[model samples]
Target: MDVTSFWLAGRPATGDETFSVTNPYDGRVVGEVAVPTEAQVEEAVAAADAVRAQAAALPVHVRAEALAHVSRRLAERSEEIARLITAENGKPLLWARAEVNRAVSVFRFAAEEARRWSPTTQRLDTDPGGAGRLAYVSRVPKGPVLGIAPFNFPLNLTAHKVAPAIAVGAPIVVKPAPATPLSALVLGEILAETDLPAGMVSVLPVPNDRAPALVDDPRLPVVSFTGSVPVGWAIRERAPRKHVTLELGGNAAAVVLADADLDWAATRIGLFSNYQAGQSCIAVQRVYVDRGVYEAFVPKLVEAVGSLVTGDPWDGATQVGPLVSTDAAERVESWVNEAVAAGAKVLTGGTRDGAVYAPTVLADVPADAKVLREEVFGPVLVVQPVDGVDEAFAQVNDSSFGLQAGVFTRSLDVAFRAHRELNVGGVIIGDVPSYRADQMPYGGVKDSGVGREGLHSAMSDYTEEKVMVLTGIDL
Candidate 1:
């Protein structure tokens, strides 16, 4: 395979040293990528800082057209990009295709939001003290952004950071996860093709150890991170003065109320629990079914999990594939063993084969097992029986990570109650916690992190409001 160049200030550049990205499935070297030198990283940062004013002053149409161009190009080259995602990230082909499509929509939405950007006017003459005054308020870019992306949805997650920064006129420096940086480099290549300013974007595969200096740099005032709980919080604490947004994963729960369609619930839970090899932050890690339906639901869920096909990711029909590495699979296997030792019974699938762990289910789990209390980050899920809705909601809220939760129910009142009672970023009423639209408001409370994602929401996160008061306005 040819060497993949990192994007430095919208141009491809190679560094002194290179690293190989190997396929997690078979341990074959898929491609080699250049690691950015410290000097190269500094140059990229300085360029972004120097072009901050120019990037912030670009015309809305210029930003919109640039974003639209990227969206169109991604749609045109969907298959090639999807294959690359599967090759390095070990996700199945179908899901890789879905990720590319989601990224396409993300840029499209950013373009629309750029066109719709406008200031709001409010009259400040309600009382005689503020006669003939009007306040015009607009949200402006805070500063240059530092986006740190994770490996699970490498393409789309990076897009979530870069697209919004571009739409809102914020120059951004991206550090893609070292494990899966090829897709992001490809995205940077596409961004380079746009007519936007040169310093608007940079994709650098910086090592994890050297990321703190970027976070602490005052030039980049905003940091957007999506990864594990400890790392996300460490970034925030390290840069307490910067505007930080975290989309950390959680031990997401799926609540199956007694009134839910049991079969549909079982199928969705099974599929999402293991999708993307269960590396997703919102993947279903916990399940709480009403005791009235627990006996009926467990068998169907087991059958659904058993029917899923797992093998090489390049195959078109594979529903599950390897984890990102054998190390990740081993960690998952250890967690499952620990859960079983603590008296949790495996309803199905408690085996590992190299880098792939079988989609496993557990029942009668204690509340404190690592598989139940913490993020398993694997294809393992723990299920428990709840006596009622109150108990189910309580169990879902019990986690320190309150990212998102799924509740299966058909009743309108129960849906409203779930919306009101669940302490999470999003409440999916009829599906699993893994269901996320690229254009909706997303993020979590508590340990799950701060701020929101999606087109308009992320734009707001990258900007702060500025008020201009005109005192000579006539009433």
Candidate 2:
């Protein structure tokens, strides 16, 4: 197997201890990555702090040009990065390619944001209380940012953290998930070629136990983490007083109204629930169908889901691949079995082989069941029937997560109702909650997360606003 080293302070850092990265399909070792020690994590933080000022002082145009370079370089190597993502994260090649494209878009968006960023000017004399003063609110870098990325969407999610920090001129230390560090390390390699300062970025693949060193360190003033809810909240509790943005877990739902087209809704529901093995935060885990159309929609959804091909991720024909590991597949199986024991019927697909779990569709699952209540993070979807749009909306809202929800309705009133009543960061009309534009503000509410994460939104999170007032100045 090939060996990869962590990218630290514009150079590769190798250590004696290493962890193996295996392909979830067939259990073959793809590569090995060196694990950083806690001391190394501290070193990375200090290194980032050393050049924080240089990164913060970089001119906006210079930062924009550098991000543009990174974007161009990424586009050139898209295929290579996509293959790496597939090998490590167990996502199909097609989806991996899409993720690469999204990562490139993220950098481009950040580049554009960097070039166009400007302070908001306010007239301080609105009420004649400050007659001759003008005030302006400017966003400044929040110093060293500790960015922790998850395994799923390894490239784009890391970009969501790293690209914005660079756009806003904040030095960052990224600790990618150990299972999928190669993609982020490859990104770090591309970024190392840019004109960013020496200590501006570091991609360290450290053990989970040692993550606290990076999280609770005093030198890093900002913490942006994308992962499970428990881990994210724990990090927030342990970290010092700093700007923290947590993009945590979600058990997202999609409501199918009686007025909706069942075929269209079923097609979208199947596509998203099985996409990338249903590892997305906003993947349609729970679907609430209006009882009038429940019988028709469920069968169509089962047929649509049954048609998906599950096999080797490298195969172009494969639509769904293995879960991240055999253990994850086992967990999904247990959850399905638990739901089954609790009186839920499997409409189709409740089987597993090695790391591969067939796309599952469950009907009549109780609200209190584990599969219905928790973030499965697998290719299992629960479809529940509701009386009407009101009941469907209520069922969708009955979750600890409020990341995003989808409502399939033709009526503007229903759409507006979902928009107003559904407790989520975003409500999608006529599509699955899985839909997300790379430039849109995306995050969660409640246990889902604490902050938003698009190019502009993340730039805002990585920066702090300061108001400057000139006294006795002509307006």
185-228 in candidate 1: lDDT tens per residue?
99999999999888889999989998998998899999999999
Top model by TM-score, which number?
A: 1
Error of 1 at 14 (Å): 0.6
Regions of candidate 1 where Cα sits further than 4 Å from its true position: none
- C-alpha lDDT of residue 80 in model 2: 93
Error of 2 at 365 (Å): 1.2
For every candidate, C-alpha RMSD to the true structure in Å: 0.8, 1.2
Task: State every prediction's TM-score relative to the real structure.
Answer: 0.99, 0.98
Top lDDT model: 1
The lDDT of model 1 is 0.94
**lDDT (Cα, 0-100) at 147 in candidate 1:** 98
